[model samples]
Target: MLAHIHIRNFAIIDEVELELEGGLTVLTGETGAGKSILVDALGLALGDRADAAAVRHGQKRAEIALTVDVGALPAVRDWLAEQMIDEGDECLIRRVIGAEGRSRAFINGQPVPLASLRTLGEQLVDIHGQHAHQSLLRGDEQRRLLDHHGGLEALATDTAQAWQQWQADRRTLEEALGSREERDARLELLRYQVEELEALALAEGELETLETEHRRLAHAEKLAAGVQAALAALYEEEFAAQPVVARQLRQLETLAELDPALASVRDLLKDAEIQLGEAADGLRRYADDADIDPQRVQWADRRLGRIRELARKHRVEEQALHAVLPELTAELEALEALDAKLEHLEQAVERSEQAWRALAEQLSQGRQQAAKSLGGEVTALMQALGMAGGRFEVAINALAPGKARASGLDGVEFLVSANPGQPPRALSRVASGGELSRIALAIQVIAADAGSTPCMVFDEVDAGIGGGVAEIVGRKLRELGERCQVLCVTHVPQVASQGHRHLHVSKSGGRQTRTKIQRLDDTGRVEELARMLGGVEITARTRAHAEEMLGQAAQSAALRRT
Candidate 1:
């Protein structure tokens, strides 16, 4: 149940704080007093779409906050826990809408997506707008209400899922069968491509190896010549540097006996001579081992040419050629098994259709049973609301199985007859605005007990009918409050008189007007009710009548409790 709400800079409200209770609370005010604005603010907190105009003129933003007591709702508690924002049994929801048309939502002070707030809000509050009857003319809405009334939402969801699965499988089968020629052509191409790539048998790093070997073989003669020339310069020729360094070392060693400084030069000459000998030996081995083979060079060049050709044919780099084979092979395998796959998909479509039919049939049966019960109840309520001998019916028409939709194979329409001895016809054609309002109220009152939401808000649901009908509507709402909190915005004096709590909304100020809501005490309630009943002027007689109404309503409430 909603325990508290704080609103700031919203519409005509500059700032307001309201401490709420769990019962039927009524808000009464003159037209344009912003009675519905409070309901709109609560709707915004519950994740309704926000508008920049909702922010008070010249204000930067509008803010709405609500504190909900979830002690009795284990599902809500579990949802809070799952979101990792649980704080005992109370949940705080806040909404801020900037003047620039941007909005943000928070749960327990932690920023959350608007969708998260909506999900949690559905579990906490069920708001019935004044215009609900207008939408009730829709077939889909009728079906949804029926399912909700019958507690068949889960079964309907299962049926929808099965229908979706059947459609998906059927689409796949149709696509495959329709594109058989294209599939066959693609299959042939993939098979050939896979074969060619497999035959090449390229390995990782093999491209770099082949290129290296090709360069080496192609330049074998030039490399050999360079080695021979270096060998001659270092040691191979007569009177080469090796023998010269040896003679220099012998003279330096002899002088070193006389002067120790010459010993350093002698050691340098000896090291130079040793390096020259090692160079000559290395050059001799290379001349012996050099492969200057024309046959191998030709073979390396042909292998490289073939790799480049295949790379260009496949529209890939030579280095990437190794990846092409596996991809083509996988596609080829899939196409090769097309017949088997089509058979499997056909069976899947058949099975899915069967599952969908079973669930839809079960749902149809439930709706039929629920329809009978609901029609009878709403018809009875219509009579109580002053539509004597009125008739209400739920007409279910079956749809073709081959063209089944996600909702089901049934189309539901609400039929109504608003006068005695009149044949029931489509509600949209037969009911007036006032009659629709009464009918909508009837459905809501009946379905209220079927829902588990802790709070229900009605925005002038009693908009049309009046007199005794208004009093009955008020009593029904008060009865509903026994199970959960209900907040109603109404102008009906009878309805306002029946609430467990009454709030009077009035506008003050001129250009910068602000809406103020005050909870009415006994005398205040009498005055407000007198104003509603007597309109522009409140006389002593009107005041007396308002007091008597309150007295009788209180007595009736006490009797019901007993």
Candidate 2:
């Protein structure tokens, strides 16, 4: 419920603070009395688009704030938790619009994006205006309104979930079907590529091994020739150097027998002969083992070249060729299985469509029943609001062949005939602005028990209504207030008299005026009602009449309570 509203430098309202209470509150004023300005300020505080022209003269900015009590509203509590805003018992929405058209919004004293403020405001209050009458003409809105009235939110949610699942399944199936042709071509290409790669029979590290062997074999002839030359120099019969060393060692041994110092030279010569003999033996072994075959070298080179060529063809390094082979094989296998997968997807789609149709049919039946009940309730409400001959109907038609949606398979449109002998037409097309407001009121009153919003605002709902009709409108508004907080702007004394609270708006100076809202006592209310009844003059008869109207309104309210 809206607890308070404060406005500063907004249009003709220079500064005003209004403490509001639950139940019907009416703002009454003469023409050009800034009544609309109050509503405009509230609209801005509720996240409506800001206009620089709304700023009062001599002010740089216009500010509006609304305090809403939401302690008992679970939806609001949950929403606030979700938004991560901190507030106790009440939520305050504030908007400041600069003279340059720049605007900012805040929730509970914490700055917030305008969009967030808008979302929260919608959850808190619903503003009904004459222009909103067009909503009755829309099939979608009608369906939603009816659904809300029927308290079938859970069923609608189930239907929506089922529909989303069905759509997802269908999308999966379509994607599978659409890829068949592409998959077939891909399968063929993968098969050829896999076969080509398999035929190469590439092995890890095989290229490196082949290159090493090729280098060794290419140098084999030169290595063998150098070993042979070293063997001849060390061990060949006539050209042997080791035999000469042996003969010199014998002569040194004979000389050592004559001189002790010469024995050291003989021992050194003996060691040199032993080392030379070992070196010659090593050269012989190396010569015997060296590779000299050109065919082996050519074979190693060809193997390395084949590996390089395969790597180049696959656009990978020679060592990475082996890794590519496995991935290519997997791709081929996947492509080969496309047809089977596609068949499964098609079956899934069929089952999903069937499930969707079943759920949609059930939902359609529920909506049909709900629409009937809703139409009856609204029709009764219309009769009470001075549309005695008005006929209200809910027309439901299928939007799709079999599939359902979040709302239902059927489209709902509200039809009305405001006069006797008149054919029912779309409510938007048949009703005048005043009739539309009353119709909206009726619908809202019927839907109040099912909706979550705690407050409803009607702008000039009493337009084009007076006398007994105005009294009826007032009674209905007061009845609606019993269910939810209602704020109505009206010029009718009867309507104004029905409110639990009354606010008066008037322009004082050329550009300096203010709006004042006060919770009226019984006497003050009567006085205000008298003023509403007799223009600017409050005669004794008018005051008496106003008191009588208040007494009747009280009696009606008491009966409604019973």
Candidate 3:
């Protein structure tokens, strides 16, 4: 239920904060007094498109915020939780529209996209615009209303998803079937590529190893000469380091016997001689073990050439050639299994089609059932709204199989018979403006009652009707409020008097005209009602009439509660 609304610098509204309660609440004022502006501002908070012109003149921006109780609304709570912005039991939605037409929206203090605000808003409030009846003439709107009233929205959504999936799969299968020659060509190419890669049989890291070996063999002679020179300098020559170090070590040893300090130097000379000898031995072994055969050099060159040639052929680096094999092989395997895949996709398409058909059928049945009930209910409401013999019917026509749509296979239209003995005809064809308004009101009331949205806003729902009919319309709304929160923008005194709470919107100031709204007390309601009944004058008779109307409305409400 909507708990509060705070609007500032919105249109003629300078600043107005209202703490709203459950049940019927009405806003009434003179023409251009900005009663409907409040509803529009509420719409802004509920994610309606913003307009720069909606900002008050000379103001930088317009702001509107709404607080609603979500304790009983699991769907709304679930949405908040999914968005990770849940505030226990209450939801706050705010919108700001800059004078430059830029807009920002927020939910639970977290900035959100307009679409997210809209998505969550729908579950919390359902606004019935003053001109809603205009859109009701469209076929799509009629279908949507039927679906919404029937509680088949989820089923319809599932049907649409299934149909889309089936269509997508069909397209895929058709594309595949159309390209058989291309598939055959691709298969041939892939098979040859896979065979070529398999023949190479390259192993991971093997290329690097082969290249190192090839470099070693290609420069073997230079390496062997370098190693022999090193050995001669270290040990092979008679004046090599090993012989020099041995002569030095014996001299140091003789001196160390006379002086202990020279003993350490003698040990160092001996260690150096031993190390030099080991180095010469290592170099000699390397020279002996080195492979310097020309045949091996040619073999290494050929092996590297093959690997590089294949790498260039595949447009890959020699180091990456090994990775391409598995990729090509996998594609070849899949292409070889094309027939199996085709069969599987075909089966998938069939299953999706069946699923869509089943869901559509269920939706159709549900609509049929709901249509009968809704038509009967609306026809009854029309009777109370001064349409004595008017009849309402939901016409369900099946579409041809070739002309299927995602919503369902059935086309929905609202048919009306305004007089007894007249055949029911399309609303647009037979219903007059007044009749349309009444029918629209009846349908809206029924739909709103059936829906789960916690709050309903009806702007001028009693338009085109007056006298006892207006009072009846007001009664219907008040009765609806008994179940949920209701906010109505009304001009008729009969309707205004029926509200459990009344707010009077009045404009003041000359060039800086601002709209102010205040809740009405009993005396205030009577005076306001009298003003509505009387034009620009308040008389004793109008006051008495207004008092009577309020008295009757109060009695009716009391009886309803009982």
On lDDT, the leading prediction is 3
lDDT scores of the candidates, listed in order: 0.90, 0.81, 0.91
lDDT tens digits, residue span 222-322, model 2: 77888898888887867588988998899988989999899888989899999999999899888777757878878787777777787898899887888
Which 10-residue span in candidate 2 carries the lowest summed lDDT?
509-518
Off by over 4 Å in 1: 165-178, 188-331, 338-355
What lDDT tens digits, residue by residue, belong to model 3 across residues 1-562? 9998999999999999999999999999888999888888888888899999999999999999988989988888888999999999988899999999999999989999999999988888899988989999999999888888988888988999999999999999998789889989998988888888788788999998989989999899889999999998987798988888988898898899899999888888888988988888899899989978899899889888988898998899889999999998888888879879899889989998899999999999999999998999999998998889989999999998688889888999999999999999999999999899889999999999998888999998788888999999899899999999999999899999899899999999887998889999999999999999998999999999999999999999998778
Assess candidate 3 and give its lDDT.
Answer: 0.91
Candidate 1, residues 348-401, lDDT tens digits: the string is 999998999899999999999889988998999999999999999999889875
- Over the full model, what C-alpha lDDT does candidate 1 score relative to the true structure? 0.90
Candidate 2: regions farther than 4 A off: 74-93, 100-108, 112-116, 152-209, 215-237, 241-245, 248-272, 283-301, 314-366, 385-389, 401-410, 417-425, 428-438, 518-548, 558-562
Off by over 4 Å in 3: 174-178, 185-332
